[model samples]
Target: MDIRTLQEELVQYSKTIGIDKIGFASASPFIELKERLVRQQELGYQSGFEEPDLDKRTNPELVLPQAKSIIAIALAYPSKLKDAPRSTRSERRGIFCRASWGQDYHDVLRDRLRKLEAFLQERVPTCKVKSMVDTGELSDRAVAERAGIGWSGKNCAIITPEFGSYVYLGEMITDLPFIPDKPIEDNCGTCTKCIDACPTGALIQGGQLDSNKCIAFITQTKGFIADQYREKIGNRLYGCDTCQLVCPENKGKDFHFHEEMEPDPEVVKPVLKPLLSMSNREFKERFGSISGSWRGKKPIQRNAIIALAHYKDQSAIDELKKVLIEDPRPVMRGTAAWAIGKIDGESSQEILLNAKNKEKDQDVLNEIEKGLQLITR
Candidate 1:
């Protein structure tokens, strides 16, 4: 078979493997991105994107030993809105961004890519094909842009006409040669909605994110959030979608028809009351297969309490009280106290004082005092 016919077959195989968008590009070094990786690693921002190694990510050779061509595929996570009054102005958003609203994108994307790789291996017994989703050092986004899958928008995401940036990216690095598509240029001239919409100023310059200030980064980091950043985090429970939501490219476009990207019902703007009530085992059991389960319950619960406090939702007081008293994680108790103070207000004065008296952990007690202070103020 000709290379075009062989590549065409892989595309068909990718559809069977559950990929929503598949595009092809030959392997080429990305010199500009490699230089930027140095700064990204030095700043401690990559985080869960990769293990803490500057070299492993900067060098594509680490991903595929004899890499010659790359096939970049995109899987769109449905950005469907449930039938309700969501996306409202008084937003205490407890939901994830559409990218992560469903099954773990990494899991879903990787499985499909692996299937494609296996099929390629079966067809060409001597050729080498490696499937990866961010595990490899290859530039997934750059390769995607080159593949005609999408252009890299000002948001630094590969934006395609089909799904915007809601699609998950995965790749197959292989030895076989194939015709590569020409890359499209940036179409975001004079548009700054995504940059302007970043609440924490993470999007400082076009296509740049200061992960230190990013709420998505802040939520997952293993330390206390700095005092100045609390109010800016708003009510985002998991990840913030302000940038994507405000993009003109995403405007008036509906993703409701796409079932592959549909978010699971359990996490779609989940009530804070239910989230705080979960025991660790229950959390693991409930979210094990979902995208939110990757960090375990503590991170999500901590963010939930923060959101409740920020929103001043009185309905969360009961759950917050229980968390303050019984959560094994001190971080949870401290965040709960802070949230309770913000939520219960004058009505929860007694609960606040009792919690203050009962709180033994120093950090948690300090937060209790802060909660009390918020009440007094």
Candidate 2:
């Protein structure tokens, strides 16, 4: 089999299977990324969610011993929600980031990668291939960048001319030597929008992110949010899109190419008060299909509490009181206590004083005290 023809066939097949963009690159070691990863670790900027091994993360050969080339694919997702419901004072809502708007991209991209892998295997029976989405060891951005799918933007996202930064990336490493495409030039030359818009100053500079300071990362954390960032969280229930939303490249670049990527207005931007009382099973039934639920309901619920505080939604006082007094999780109770104080309802001080007495967890007690202080302030 001519490897060139096989590559061409794979590319065509990819289009037929709904791949938005496809590119090829040599499965060479990512030398530059290795140095960045080392520096990221030394600075403690890692999100703690990445593959810890630097060698495996930067070297495709380590991931697939027989690798000779990589096939990078991108699927564009909708950046804007259609007919979106507004969040009003009476019914304050929290938003999940655009990345979590639709069904989990992991499942969607993984399905596409498997089909591509099957197509490759059918042509070259002796070829070896390994496919990975976000969870894979090799960096998807690095692979996509080298393959000309897009240039790595200042926002730390792969910015394709067609899809902007609102694209989901996946890659497959193959043993066969497919011709590699040249990398796209960096187009974010003078754009400081994404860096300037980051609420937490996570974008330390162009293409570098301190995940600890990233609101996107902070929303996914299972523990209590830091005081400094808690108020900044706003109404975001999961992930943060300020950086991407502010990019000029993404202007009017909404894509509804994939039906699975369309968001259900109610699910992605749900009312805040209801989320505080959602049972684990109810949460699963409502949000299990989306990517944001991967961290489970706790983080989302925690953020919901903070969002209520951000809005100072007096209507949510009862919900916050219930969570403070009865929620088993200390993080939830603590967050609710803080929110009640921040909201400063007529009974807010009384509720926190009551919770402070019954709260055995020192953390929750501390939050209750803080809530009382907030009310006093």
Query: Which residue pairs show collisions in model 1?
Result: 77-261, 78-261
Q: Cα-based RMSD of the predictions, in order?
A: 2.8, 0.9
Q: Give the alpha carbon lDDT tens digit for every residue of 7-118 in model 2.
A: 8888899999999999999998999999999999999999999999999999999999978999999999998889999999899999999999889999999999999988
Positional deviation of 331 in candidate 2, in angstroms?
A: 0.5
What is the C-alpha lDDT profile of model 1 across 162-193, one tens digit per residue?
A: 77777778888788887887777777889998
Error of 2 at 351 (Å): 0.9
Q: Local distance difference test, per candidate? A: 0.74, 0.93
Model 1: residues >4 Å from true position, as ranges? 15-17, 42-45, 85-93, 256-260
Error of 1 at 196 (Å): 0.9
Q: Score candidate 1 by TM-score against the native.
A: 0.89
Highest-scoring model, TM-score: 2
TM-scores, one per candidate: 0.89, 0.99
